[model samples]
Target: MRFFNTEGPVRPTDHYSLPPLERWDLNEILTFIEQKKYFLLHAPRQTGKTTCLLALMDHLNRTGLYRACYANIEGAQAAREDVERGMAIICSVLARSAQHYLQDSRLNNWVRADGALVPAGDRLFQLLEYWAAADARPAVLLLDEVDALVGDTLISLLRQVRAGYTQRPNGFPQTLILCGVRDLRDYRIHGSSERDPITGGSAFNIKAKSLRLDDFSAAEVRTLLLRHTAETGQVFTSEALDRVWDLTQGQPWLVNTLAYRACFELPEGRDRTRPITLALIDQAKEALILERVTHLDQLAYKLREPRVRHVIEPMLAGTALGDVPDDDIQYLLDLGLLRQGNGGLTIANPIYREVLPRTLAFTPQASLPQIYPTWLNADGSLNPTALLEAFLAFWRQHGEPLLRSAPYHEIAPHLVLMAFLHRVVNGGGTLEREYAIGMGRMDLCLRYGAVTLGMELKVWRDGAPDPLTEGLIQLDGYLAGLGLSSGWLVIFDRRADQPPMAERTASSTTVSPHGRSIELVRA
Candidate 1:
């Protein structure tokens, strides 16, 4: 029976997937290949580059237009230090791929010929040339994981492909597509001396065009999932589809992962006629994030990279970083970590934004508990007076130590303040957190039953007077939107000379146009 595939490439018999050819923008690619144009195909790992290449190869072979072969050079990465070993492995993989796809033993034999097999400096290029020559139809080569090789090995492979570009259609392969997670232009190689800088020598410049495989569109995602419905008669409700999109932004692996878990891993009796709903998708998202699956973990690790931070930091602050280079943004987009929105760049999906902060600070100390009071009067309302009094006392005693011990020292004061509130509110309610690098502030929404409390947290910098007036104005606006009577503004006076838990209270609630007054609290 067909099922959702989260592992490797999906085979037709194993899963009902989008026709692989239809998954990519193949017309543009084929047009370039038809013109004998060498190009690059790149996308983050597990976005189906390999599957797309295999499908394209089958199409080319079946149409009798070209003798196509797809080979992965990832194994060559292990042999990088020894060029001869790497070359041999490359030739072997290529020969194996060609034999499997074309069933042509001669192609392998031609590659293994005396001078052809071991052409010293450019042995791999000679092998490719000989195979292209041996084929009746012009050969199309898909070099998967082209970026895996390092140093001279990577440089040699690219230069050889460039050197043989002119002989295409007659001597060299008619079309060569280098496939990898990153574009060739981003490749930085160091020479044998280890000190020699080879920035722009004979690199791979033969690329006529570059194509990136993108995540499924919203419509495409629906279609892919509905294929399962069509086959198994189990439908995903409209809300479920929307939730999937909201959580994954149609990221291929994430979409597939959620569907796989829901359909296959959810409790047996629960897979009845009841359609999968938004709630189920939410559950799957929570599970996946908590589980820290490989793909998500790897993506989270990339947030530490300076290039990723360049884009993410501003977005978190609810602002756009000005004029990020197209290539850099595209790299992140290709990785399925960020998406372009009408407003600007945002984390690709809500789940990612939710997971990012926790993932970034992956330590037991970072997992501060959320604090909320329960067992209030039966109306689901919190005892505001008691809660406030208790928090004040707690803050007075341990607040300084907590602030000093916060893991993010740069933002320690603000984090500790939030942590304190969270610890107090954990048992009975929810706290929504929003903070971005360079945002200079954190927004927290505490929900205790029907009582909604909004707080804007800012750390006092350079002994500046508390931003109480500004905080009151912001809190007033927030309360007005929520149609609430009052709210609290908590500011951390990081530079204050006063002892911890020292509180200054001001209680003239400013009334908004909507008649809601915001009460200000400064600690």
Candidate 2:
């Protein structure tokens, strides 16, 4: 009766899961622990860091090599700049964890018994020193969500750990592992009085190395899905399995959530006799996105951050990343919002690719003016010509104002257009997007009933020439990929000298170099 686990830590008995240790380099980790090196284990939220840490603690304890305990210090986040409160919370949690995990009760009442006398900065150091002295086996501490501590609280924690680094195995924890969504190097801690932010490296210079936990590989994704089949005798078609990998790119929580929805939540998928098919997988993905599930919703919330917008806006518009800082890009990569592909920085996966733009356009989509479905025929088929006309009229009257609602200014036009199209395909159709670094254009494919429409969005900047010829060539390639002879190419005029939106917005018919008919819209 094991199910795919999407929440909290994975328990093998209750959930179908890959062996946690197998996801990491066991030898490297053991080497760090044996050497008593303080280090970091980081990955995006919900990538199974807690599950892995718990398993590692059990492994170390069972081997009789160490007395290990895993404690989540995220609860200390609420203390913010209050160093004393944060330290007390952290110490008490660690004490409870030690008692539970190793039957070590020496530090159980240490927080209430002695913490008030010691300085907030020295409390953690004192607790660890006493705990290590009480055990013959070296104490291995795995602290999860270490980054959740903020400001002065975070600074005190790191400085205390650094202060006690010299006393190892005998006086302090042998191997201290900090786990969080971002590597410690990414921590920019601002203290209450400091003029400049404190880098994590300066506070905790003893870190030996940073290890990143990665998403599951394609093979691992397959193995997890097949486990459900083996247990329930409800098969997943080959295409459905591949679709899952394509959408999630092996993000652990996403894979589990999608599979859980497909197998348990969706009524059609619950039937033991019915094989999970490609269509069902797509339905599950759409449902997950529309439901605005917590995982994806948190990701969408990140788009509002200036750093995130810096990297994402240009990527969305398919423009060169001009003067973007290395740390900003690294931040997105660490958040698992972007990945380093052979093609350079790309959104992590297909599911994210769709989610980012739709999330960006959500407000504009809602603000869209009321307009009848002039683009649809009596039989509910899309009329490409009519759709273009409707869009042109919409742009003339409301597009300029709607642009104000776009998430990022650089890509406002793209967002506004997507908003209109999202309204077009609201309930019955699908909108697929293909944009990436160096692509120089965002390609979109809209499928409504029996009709498919292709589009390419380009911007005509201040110093650039009209993108008409270039867009035609690109749209021709895009249409060919979709196996269609016709599509639309939209060039938003962003040049400083351009006329007003209402006056300049217009469309014309043209033929691509490949002789495919193209509906060219210039706005």
Candidate 3:
């Protein structure tokens, strides 16, 4: 009775999996370790860094090449300032891990030499030295969740590891691998007095190489799903696989979560033998997003951090921040929040693109009832005039209220409008949204059966002139890209002179180049 695991480390006897070791390029990692080199291994949270490290440790230990052990140092994060307390926790965890893996009490004994754990700031290196001396074979150490330690404690840990690098293969651990959600180069240690403020100095430069574990590839995701089918005789339809890939973009946790939910949690007596379908996948996606599970919730919290804002705001505006630091972009990329595309940055996947704006608009009223409906006709056609009139009225009455209450106040007007549109057509239609930090425009495409409506939303500052002409051109281009003849240009006129709807003549319909028509609606 095996099942897909979406939680912590997968055990061999459990309904677990080991994504083919052959599929990953671990030779470089092995070579680095064999050469007694220290390095960093990082990727987005829950992307299997711990699993991979554990597997690698098993391989190394079983091959009789090295004595390997994995320990998480996150517990030391709280005792950051009290170096002594942090070191004691680190020593205790390392001892426990060694006792579990090596089945040898000697490793633990050495760590707790003379019935006393070494004091903070000194325990980690001392334990490493003792273990290297006590072990018959060279040792490989994997430090998981290294980034969880913050401020001075993190700096102390890194510095100690760097200090002990020279004694490797003899008095120190033969190889060290620091695993976390960020690469070492991106480490922004704040309370360190030894490093220069402007240019982060070399507090710890022992890293010989930095390896990033990437998301599952399309083929790999298929193989993972097929493994379950082979075991349980349950099948996944092709369209289901396509939808899963589209929604999760091969995020490992998401893929496993969806599969687990599909096979185990779906309503009973459904069509289980017909192979899962795209609609099922969509259902699971919606459920997960609505649940705001741990992974998604953690990512949402990061949105409030200034570093995330620096990258996301520009992408939302449809503009680029040319002078942005590489580390800032890299941090977001490592978090699975952004992806590299077209030689520039883009939302990592479609699900993120949809979730980012909606999540940013978190508020009780943002999810309020929509007085307007999404469909214009009974035949799944859009009624542009009705849609515009409803939006205009809604905007005039509650537009200010919604904007003022949005979580991301800067993008409140735009998101509130989208929320209104989403509520209206959510049942019968689909809205494809694309916006990123620093990008100046939010492009949206409304799909209603056979007809597609494209729109570009923008906001004008108080002193800036009207953006209708520019918005129309942009909307026309967007429409043409979608092979549509006409669309709407919705602008939030924040300028002081902008009058109410009744007094506003600027909000009207017009035709642009190549006979492309646009209705400029002001809120």
Model 3: per-residue Cα lDDT over 1-523, one tens digit each: 6777798876666654655355468888888987899888888987888888888889898899799999998888888677777777788888999889988687577766742645566677877888888867998999998877767677778878888889988899989999999776645676543133422765567778788888888988898888878876778889998888888888889888988877778773134566777777777777777678888888888888777877787677666666777777888998988888775778887777877776776572455555756437776577777777777777766776677677666677777877777776665666778776554689888776677788888888776677776777777777888998888887777666657644452368789766887887766
lDDT winner between candidates 2 and 3 = 2
True lDDT of residue 134, candidate 2? 82
Error of 3 at 195 (Å): 12
Best by lDDT: 2
Question: Candidate 2, which ten residues in sequence have the lowest lDDT sum?
Answer: 192-201
Index of the highest-TM-score prediction:
2
What TM-score does structure 1 among the candidates reach? Answer: 0.82
lDDT of every predicted structure (CA atoms): 0.72, 0.91, 0.77
> What does candidate 1's lDDT look like per residue over 171-258, in tens digits?
9999998899875554556665333557654377677877778888899889988988887788898989888887777778889989
Report the poorest 10 consecutive residues by lDDT, candidate 3: 190-199
Evaluation by TM-score, superior candidate among 1 and 2? 2
Ranking by TM-score: 2, 3, 1
Q: For all the candidates, what are their Cα RMSDs to the real structure? A: 4.5, 1.6, 3.4
Residue 350, model 2, lDDT: 92
The residue-by-residue lDDT of candidate 2 on 288-330, one tens digit each, is 9888899999999999888888889888888889999887888
TM-score of 2: 0.97
Give the local distance difference test score of model 2: 0.91
**Candidate 2: where is the Cα deviation over 4 Å?**
186-188, 191-196, 199-201
